[model samples]
Target: MSIESGMIRWKNRVALVTGASVGIGEAICTSLVSHGMTVIGCARSKDKIDMLSNDLSKKGLSGRLIAYKCDVSNDKNIDDMFEWIAKNHGGVDVMVNNAGFSCKDTLLEITGDKMRDMLNVNVVGLVLCTSKAVKSMLTRGVDDGHIFNLNSMSGHRLTGILNFYAATKFAVTALTEGFRRELVENSKIRITAISPGLVETEFLARAFEDKDMAQSVFARCESVIKPQDIADILLFSLSSPPNIQIHDVLVRPCGEKI
Candidate 1:
């Protein structure tokens, strides 16, 4: 399919991306903006997103990037963010739930508070954002709106080191399908779950205290996916014709055993 030609329909439209300060989220924001779509990049730390916005603005692309401060773990923050979007720039046509992380603790050692925080961000936050985005599309009679959930390979299988995090992703897998089934009855809105393995990101360093060790783990891998790779996949999915609904996409680096 001609991704560029398909994206003509989305030119000047708005797309909201959570956890947009870095890694895959940041790459997605950049790709969307490059495709002539106004992108809202939201993160808990708005400074980085603001910096990115400035950089993109200087490029003078057809699209623009808006930096938004949002803590997806907090319901109030999420509600306020959506409200502001509605009031200022109309509702979102694309929703990307990419804000997710694993705690430093293993399942056996994780505290209740830490577990709750992970669930709030990974599961609850994603659900709430999807609901609001879909509602916005339906209220505005937007049949071609899309929703993307950033899942993981762990969602489809078990990983000993990240058991708890994998559980959350499994929830995402089910949610993506559930959303598609529910929305297909009333609208043509599409939902896609992107499951990726071993992307070069801060996720591992953050998950483990030792940054060097994280780097070493990636070094051992034959290949590691880049953030831009995932961004490209998302663009391809988004650029599909309205008649085509690209569902679940499971991607892994070449030679990745698991």
Candidate 2:
């Protein structure tokens, strides 16, 4: 089936994306807006989202992008954002839990506050978002709603230095499966875990605290996935026939070893 036909059900529907200011999150916002969805793109940096919205406006796409400022790590912020979404758009039909945080500090070097920061964003925040979205879907009688969690390859296997960050993603991996089990017999609500490796994004710079180092690492790689690539996979999963639940997707750039 054509993408248009596949996404017909989603046209003009309300969708919420966390961390929508940058990287895979930004690309997903662009893709969804182009596909004719009313996308609420939330990030701590609302200005960036507005800039993206402005850029997208010139395209005359079928859908629209709304900028929202939200720090997913904060419960009040998340609640406020969801409340606004519920009031303005009548609850979301799609939820993308794409916000994430990581630091280069290894287990030995990481502090309690830093560890909590990662858990708050990477695990707790994601869980809260998922719960809220599921509630919205259940209340609105929207059985076919979808949720996307931007997981990582690190979630599945241990990355030597980034082990703690990987641990949080590991929680996500288990949550994805556990969530699927909960929704199976009762609802058509779909949850997808997208695990990607070595994507060219601001992630590495943030993780390593050095843009040059991140660039050098990327230069060493033969190829790397683009943010748009992840967005495409998202659309692909969404467009699939409803019966086929795309449980998990593991993607890596060509020849990316470990």
Candidate 3:
């Protein structure tokens, strides 16, 4: 590779990706390692994390793959995960807050339990991870840090179904913008949000046990997006030059409409 092109590779940078046990988060972790970045993957599933760590070790392509079992909803676990990373990896330069949950429910018909779970996982999880990550960022004395939150297409112009999920994602987008402004003013932290249309992963399986409703959401779009597609975009956001800060990214397969 030419020097110009090689300079763009994230071979030495350190990054933390949450919700990396499966789906887009896993794809992002895999791609980051391939590009030479030291990727720290966090997920609540110990089994999946162990499998990924071992799998990547066999590939011999992984530079530094540290998989940690973390429950983002828990305060102690979140702090411990960040503390471990800081002790071993010298804090992260980029953090991807991809930990979230999805379940279909109408806004009016949504149960108290469902709403609380959604808020705890999606909104609360983001805030908790960001708080912990910011601590490491401050301790490392990193003048510049980047954060990316996985918002959804629903966060933008919500003109379709998935009302319950839409509300949570809108919260994400709002929180991202709010944090972006605050971080920019108070610190050198940069924030970006990505809203993906439809992705083909086990996310649907885990999210929707109901075959009928899952199929309904699946039918809204034509072709399902591959995890790699979102992963590539994520890498781009993280690897972009200092002056070029990506505010937001909208990724969708063809035929996906409002």
Candidate 4:
């Protein structure tokens, strides 16, 4: 089916995306906005999102983009952003838990503080955001709302030096199923986990703490996934029939080995 036909149900709907200042999150926001959805892009750096909003405005999109400042690790920030969204947009019909981070240090070399920070943003923050989204859906009586969690290939298999980061994503993998089982019984909310391998995004630079290294890693591969590629996957999942629930999607570049 065509995108317009499949996603007609989501036209003019509201969507909230975390870590939306750049990369995959930003791409998702752009795609949804182009599809006539009111998209709220939340990130720690509000300026970046604001810039993105301006850019999207210049495109003359059918929908609109709103930038909101939020630190996913902080409960107050998450709560405040959600409150503003609720007041301004009514409630969210789609929630994308895309905010996450990874430190370069190994498990033994990593400091407790760093590991805790990773867990806070990747696992706890995601869970809390999901909770708020669920509550909003329940209160607003939105039974068909969908939630997408941005997981990683590391979540499914062990990767050297990224073991700790993998653990956090594994929690996300489990949480996806946990949420589906818990919420689907009472509501039609759909939960999906998207695991992509070697996406060319700021995540690599942040994880390596070296732009050159990040570039080199992608250069070695003949083809690497792009943020837009993942965004397209998200759109496909969101456009599925109400009876079709896409539980998990693992996408890797054709040239990627692991």
Candidate 5:
């Protein structure tokens, strides 16, 4: 019902967020930690996560933030990270699959190796992480656990430049539903897809390999989605009553046409 009512249910819970070094992932970790949740932020760049942890400490956060080095694309890394979470925190009650990327190359120009790398990180990595989270929840008998996948507008509709990235997101969309169907029948676990359009993040800079172009894309728009905005939406979804499931959420800026 109310946002506060829903959020109260998650206080002191354990949450694991991928790609927590920056952008949406970082925002989610910050918000959850503020809400008295123990958050484990995982990323390939442990230094960035460590920096965020230190910043949160200075702010006198109500909860804790722990940084772990993890490259989701690597199975060994995922295994080790999940194992550490299990051993240290018992298990995760929330999982945010927010690590993803796109390259500047088009489908025609993209190299085989690059394409495979994208698939490995975007699809395989997400699936593996989801499996691990679900298994942990089951083993711990934590039926009310929630998993959120950071999808995109490209997942729902085809965009010329983002076709390849869209393909990976579309796979995520499918997996979200598939997991929901399979899990709800037996467990109370919840799965959600938070799809946003044109977020102001490092995603564009990395995608284009040009800072100016990324800034220009947002500069021309009247408004662009902010990482905190997505984090808020995620908090809302996670706050819902155990009986309710917020399956899909699509967000965009006020003036965003697509």
Candidate 6:
């Protein structure tokens, strides 16, 4: 009903965001800090994590954001990351499974390696990480928590250029919804997916390699989005009343071509 200053008193909440080294994941970390929430930020790059930790300190957001180097693609690392979480900052109350990637390939260009790697990282990795987070929650006696999956419009519609990526995201959507239904029966855990259209971020920039091309992609996009936009949604989802659950949310830029 009423929201203020992004609910800047996430006082008692703990959030874990995977792939938080940059882009949408990084935005989620910073957004949560602004909301007065402490977060566990993970990525494979130690340098990136250190950078984020320092940034948090400089922003006067110290002690609220901790960084961990985690390679979600590995089951062992997944266990280690959550184990550290459980042993350290208490069990997470919210988990944001945003660690994902897409290779430069289409149906025609797809190779066994490309397709397999993409699926392994994007889909398999997500399931493993989310499972570990939930495990900690169960042990902590947290009857309820939140899970947010970063999905894409491709998950809902066909886009030839993104065939493999779409398949992985589609799987994520299904996984989230399926778990949401089951979790509602007992635990207070709520799982939801948010599909964001072409966003202006390093992800696209790195994918295109050329600034102009990346800019063009976002320019003609039905509506260019931003990482902060998705971050806002994450905050909103976590801030919703405990009994209320948002099943699936899709956001795109206006007038953008899909």
User: Candidate 2 at 64: error in angstroms?
Assistant: 0.5
Question: Which residue pairs show collisions in model 1?
Answer: none
Model 3, 106-198: lDDT tens digits are: 676779989888888788889888867776787778757788899988888776556777888999989998888878766777788999877
lDDT of each: 0.94, 0.94, 0.79, 0.92, 0.92, 0.80
- lDDT of residue 141 for candidate 2: 99
What are the per-residue Cα lDDT tens digits for candidate 1 across 214-248? 99999899999999999999999999989989999
Clashes per candidate (backbone, < 3 Å): 0, 0, 0, 0, 0, 7
TM-score of each: 0.98, 0.98, 0.89, 0.98, 0.98, 0.92
Q: Pick the candidate with the highest lDDT.
A: 1
Model 6 per-residue lDDT tens digits across residues 166-253: 8998898889878877776768887879898777887766644567877887766666788999998877877777678887888978
Alpha-carbon runs more than 4 Å astray in model 4: none
Per-residue lDDT over 1-258 for candidate 2, one digit per residue giving the tens place of the 0 to 100 score: 767789998999989999999999999999999999999999888999999999999999999999999999999998998899999999989999999979999899999999999999999999999999999999999999999999999999986978899999999999999889998878999999999998999999999899999999999999999999999999999988888899999999999778
Decoy 4 TM-score against native:
0.98
- Those runs of model 6 whose alpha carbons end farther than 4 Å from true positions after fitting are 5-9, 208-211
Candidate 3 residue 113 Cα shift, in angstroms, is 2.0
Better of 2 and 5 by lDDT: 2
Writing each residue's lDDT as its tens digit, candidate 4 over 44-107 gives: 8889999989999999999899999899999999899889989989988899999999978988
lDDT of 3 at 97: 88
| lDDT measured at residue 249 in model 1 versus the true structure, 0 to 100 | 99
- True-vs-predicted CA distance for residue 59, candidate 1, Å: 1.2
- Residue 202, candidate 5: Cα error in Å is 0.7
Instruction: Predict model 6's lDDT versus the native.
Output: 0.80
**Which stretch of 10 consecutive residues in model 1 shows the poorest summed lDDT?**
103-112
Clashes of 5: 0
